[model samples]
Target: MAINSLKRLALLGSVAIGLALPARAQDSGPLLDLLVKKGIVNDQEAEDIRAALVKDFAANTSAGKLNLSPALTEFALSGDMRLREQFETQRTIAVPGTASVANERERVRLRFRLNGDLKLQSGWGAGFSLQTAQNADSANQTLDNIGTNYGIYLARAYVSYQPSLNWFFTGGKFKNPFFTTDLVWDADINPQGFAETHTTFLNGKDTFEVRAGQLVMKDNAEAIAAGAAPTTGVDAWLFDQQLVYTKWFGAENLSDVLFAPGFMFYNASTITSQVSGTNKEQAYNGSTKYLKIVTLPGEVNFANIYGTGTQLKTYWDFTYNTAANDRAHQSVANGGYGLPATTNKGAMSWLVGLGYGYGQGKNKGDYSLKADYRQTGISALDPNITDSDFAFNRLNQKGYKFSGSYNLTDFASLTVTYFITSRLNDSINTKAPALAADPTLSDLNSTNTLQVDLNVKF
Candidate 1:
């Protein structure tokens, strides 16, 4: 055969080997050397074939560009950054008392986050995220006027064991296991805990899922010294369980008439050390209670609303306080934080939300408008987890919130939100002489907040 024809044959063989073999096993040097020694190709021709094979492999394998490992089955990196301007206003409107208002404050804040996940071949995986924030409930760092250095926190870290596609277990600081809204759990709060989830596919477009978790809210060495029982080394723990059902009407999957309804039971223990004789739930400050909250939450989704690529969604979350009734009964006898004589022991809280949108704030022209109304009683919930942007994190308030967002690109968007709320209980304000004297601090008045945000994600 001619040397030129041999060189072409060697090149074709080398390219075939590169395509046939696994990415990590595609090195062509040994085969090229063998071909050179057999006299089928010269040294220069062998080197040329090796170079072409390397180029082909590089173009075909993701590991060549991303530096990914061959042993990993899946890997991903994702996150978002946000810039915000917030305005908070407090005014006492049309009240039968001396008018007192709080000075409005405007602040600028920035948030940056990065997350990575790696799934190994043995059905196990790990993931982590880092974010800028001052507390667990928020990931935003205020742009300081004094040029202070920003701070970053470990937001999430977890390892997962997936025995099958339908079952998984996670341990460490991880996202909340239960499906929820900001009405109960803050969006930014990743609880330190262990969780297990299982899903069962039912007949024809119906699915059932169950999730349970034991989360650590806080740890107190003082409680340990004080001999707090039923605690894991003096830790405040939350036990949660959720049972959810997803039903799809017709045959279009998520785009059709889809509804997800779920029931959640949450109980917190050993969160407050200063427990009264019988009112054990009334330990965490005056507003919050470490108690049991039973919630029913559901969402109804409409796709292609009004002939546009928009989805009209409506959600409702109703929570009843089993522990609050117990606390209320104890308060009358134990003389606790001024519960009204005729106050209903069975306190309940609820929120209703309506929204229209497409995508998860991903693409350009992806926009959403959402409005929510929430009414909470004083003892209905642990107010510590309430959204800080609403009513200044106050319980015993009835409020409405309006939010809208427009995506500018595939990974960037802008959002605007407004919140207004009024106090639900006027008697509680009169119970406190100082609050009754100051209208700005009174719960009977209304407050408003407005915020604008620009966000980028990858």
Candidate 2:
């Protein structure tokens, strides 16, 4: 009996050591302590086993070989890749002699992103990310160009300092810190500048938060030439502030509500145009003198309705540009739109959506369906930062969006989305004078878009 017990103890120790090889150094301590307490091994024997495990791990595993600094407490790597097939159709109105035209296009695109995060001592953290494309509103690369290799761009590089549990500060080109929808900002856009955030807990159950951002839009080195004298160029900026409150109710906090009210100020006097990596101008084709906006965004959630493992979600966003100036909408001869100033208020944008889901669509067997209605005015939101897929990123449009997603595995999912939209105002020109031959009119009347995507994450 003694010999058999010794053999079993030896086998158990070996199994434990093998299982702990991929785990962190501190993870083997509990198993070793248990072995010592159960009389399976002496203290010295447990120590010997631990030393052997560490040595073998360092010799075998790539992560174990990493010489991380002592001050670095944690590091993580994560990313996602997506393959997409997109289809689009646009219709043009007929004129006196010209027939109506419909243009259709189809393309396959791919997007890949990789992110690294490092957490240091004293509440400091840094993060960086790489993406496949250079567009601020998109990360997709069309699978063309004679099968040439694509270029990767630096998408996000930011450092954050959290002096306390309730306060945080970040600087550099970073992720959007505000709670918002694609109605006002694109999902892929990372704003460049600084942000401050604060949170207050109420009764340890409800919370209120404040978020502020000062983002640089453009930098001009030389003075801007106006009518007579050159005006000193002021670096254009977008300033944002928001207040969010979240409350929970009902048993086990099954019902939750959240509301965020925000304001934005865009200073774009010196921003004439922006040249992109493709040497194409991206935005600011039109004047952006007045773009102060007020926004209200909110959501409500009910968990485990009727004891089912599903959630019901309703969300909405509303924005109005208080500084939308009629003078900016004057005819092209006046350096504005082709329509009269009084006819183009262009001050409102809003969306309402509903979703039903088992999970957030990130786990195996998880599925979700969502539908929304949206309307955007020409001057209601920043055209350069809105969703690229909806209405081809054009303003003065209203549409219905439908999407569904199902996870095939914990790290893989399939999604399909459709957008059907039309012009909100048929009389005004949606394009800049440089883009349209008829500066006073636009030909495109309606658009339809479809996208199918397969995404994998790690």
Candidate 3:
């Protein structure tokens, strides 16, 4: 049986080489040819290799070794949402609202998510996820031209594989490389379809894991001078790579600390061209340009926290950021182009937070105080057409939040979030006109929002 498996593997390897992957990936030639020529890797050796790969794939998923099974893997999920009440305060009245007093409103939202991993017996595993959430509307899905409590959400899916320990591959709708938390506005919503590094490192505890992959984004291509792009494909220029390391800092009885930190970079090509490695040359003929739908500039995070699996844990997280202009919209002022300059454009931003959690097993409760600040250098009039263009235009968006959650039971929990935002734009183009409308533009242009939510998880 083992000998027969070797023959099959060798034949498959030969066919694979005759197809798509880069030549070097196949070790420069087909398996049969190599074996025949080398006079090595005997049939016996081939079987050993096959068995090793099978073991490696399992180890990769459970322990990390060589091959990653292309099998279907699914995750069990259940989520529930209670009710919500909101209060908004805005001093500037569009017309005469009769009073400047803050107004309150009633609304309800459904938040639920589930994912599955399907690894076929044929060595082809696919992954899928479904998330239902209602946070304020984004610029993505909206109707009636008004940003209301209407259902506006994100749906993403992707497929991945680890053909070998040193190599991995993936394709589909997913998250971009930079930043943490898929829910840019809400952390509960996990994003998808991002290619990532599957490397391992030895740390004190369970070793450090790293993932680096391309980020697929949308819009802003023309605005950034990245001529012609696929509506739904990954932008290699926009890469997403992360590094995470977990360990038991102290003794088993003492508290433990888990630290995951790394850098982020997403380069949406402003111009089309053949990019081999780090070099980007100019391309005129219509071709695919990399694009990732994002606003927050690339960032660096040093998240440190100490806690245990039982309950009651504490964490202190520090985050540093570099400004990125909103490439979604552009004007003729910053040179008819939209991307910011290599220097004077996107400024710097950072955030620091401290928190504590209480719970047992999956049913957990927590609270925290977080402060965030980000600065954009590109003026509203800036262009994203040239390589020098900044991804985000504007300056100084700073805020603070006090949020908490109480798990009423295994199936229910209550959450409250409060935020204060302040903006400081460059006086020159601070009031620049917007090229695209915000999906959440509703009863008012701006106001402070207070939100409350209850959730059930299974």
Writing each residue's lDDT as its tens digit, candidate 3 over 140-219 gives 21123345554424444666666655445666754333334311212332233456556454554554556565543222
Model 3, residue 61: displacement in angstroms?
Answer: 30
Q: Write model 2 residue lDDT over 1-458, tens digit each, in one string.
A: 13355654684567555575444654777877887899977777767666766776687778778899998999999999999999999776455456657889999999999999889999999999999988878899999988699999999999999999899999989999999998989899999999999999897589999999999877765554467676556677889999999998854225889999999987654454542321211233234457789999999998888456688889999999887663235212243435654566668999999998887677899999999999987668776677877776777779999999999999999999999988787666544434344331123567899999999999
| Candidate number with the higher TM-score (2 or 3) | 2
TM-score of 1: 0.78
Per lDDT, what order, best first? 2, 1, 3
Backbone clashes per model, in order?
A: 0, 0, 48
- Give the best candidate by lDDT: 2
Give each prediction's root-mean-square deviation over alpha carbons.
Answer: 6.3, 4.4, 15.5
In TM-score terms, which candidate is top?
A: 2
What local distance difference test score does each model get? 0.70, 0.78, 0.39
User: Which regions of candidate 3 deviate over 4 angstroms?
Assistant: 1-82, 90-106, 119-124, 133-154, 162-169, 175-194, 203-206, 219-237, 251-346, 364-395, 425-447
Better of 1 and 2 by lDDT: 2
Per-candidate TM-score against the hidden true structure: 0.78, 0.87, 0.51
> Which 10-residue span in candidate 1 carries the lowest summed lDDT?
274-283
List candidate 1 stretches off by more than 4 Å. Answer: 1-71, 91-97, 222-233, 251-269, 272-290, 328-336, 434-444
